[model samples]
Target: MTKIHTLSCDIETHSSTDLAKSGVYRYCEAEDFEVLLFGYSVDGREAQVVDLANGEQMPRETLDALNDVRVEKWAFNAAFERICLSRFLGLSTGTYLDPASWRCTMVWSEYLGLPLSLMGVGAVLGLEKQKLSEGKDLIRYFCTPCNPTIANGG
Candidate 1:
């Protein structure tokens, strides 16, 4: 059997722009846009996270896989990952990574009449090690815009 190279990724980002209102492209254009964390697994193995917001560099292997057409990139919402990574890699504004090389699990779930979210899908499938229940709350805390106040460590 031929082995296929796949990199599954999820990223947490912080942006002043409202992603729900503006969409991924506009969200990427925000001045305060930043990729806080990049989590990925190679060939379905255990995942690793790169803490970019804290100044951690992505590993060279992950970098190469992202750019390599031979390596199929998979994510729940693949377009977001591709576009965000394009900006993070300093690609020209409005230009994004090739969508042809990416796959979206959300699309698959929708096609199968399953829930679109990772957590929802896990619950539906009764998968072991389902997504964390507190993930959404944490995402709201770290990935969304917040008032800059002394009490909140602004």
Candidate 2:
């Protein structure tokens, strides 16, 4: 087996709450939607987060790493991250990273019939301080369109 250099990444995306209502094709094509936040760890250390919302971009090396076949990318639900990154970077997912090179932690969790959420999985494994406690709220706020009143600051 070939040794793999792993890069763990998590991305926050903005989309509608009603994914079904918009459909996958439309949802993926939604306007003003892009990666809001990116959290990543190389070899499981030196964790870093970049708020793309603040006009931050991943380091060139990180982008290069994604294009390298020798490096494996890990994400909880890699398809979502991969798609989001592709959209954000204006590159097709097929051109960025091979699906085979990405690992989904959620898959492992599902294999064990354990909880698939990051927090739930962390809790099950006794991991201290899972990524974000208020991830749902964050997702709702950033990913979905704000309520009309809230958007209007009412």
The top-ranked prediction according to TM-score is: 1
Where is the poorest 10-residue window by lDDT in model 2? 17-26
lDDT of 2 by residue, 1-154 (tens): 3333888998877775356586444565676667788899888788899888899888887877776767889998887777667667777534544677888989988999989788888888888777677878877766887689968888
Find the candidate with the highest lDDT and give its number: 1
In order, candidate lDDTs are: 0.90, 0.76
Residue 143, candidate 2: how far off, in angstroms?
2.2
Poorest 10 consecutive residues of model 1 by lDDT? 1-10
Cα RMSD, each candidate: 3.0, 3.7
Write candidate 1's Cα lDDT for 70-99 as tens digits: 889999989899999999888889677888
Off by over 4 Å in 1: 1-4, 148-154
Local distance difference test, candidate 2: 0.76
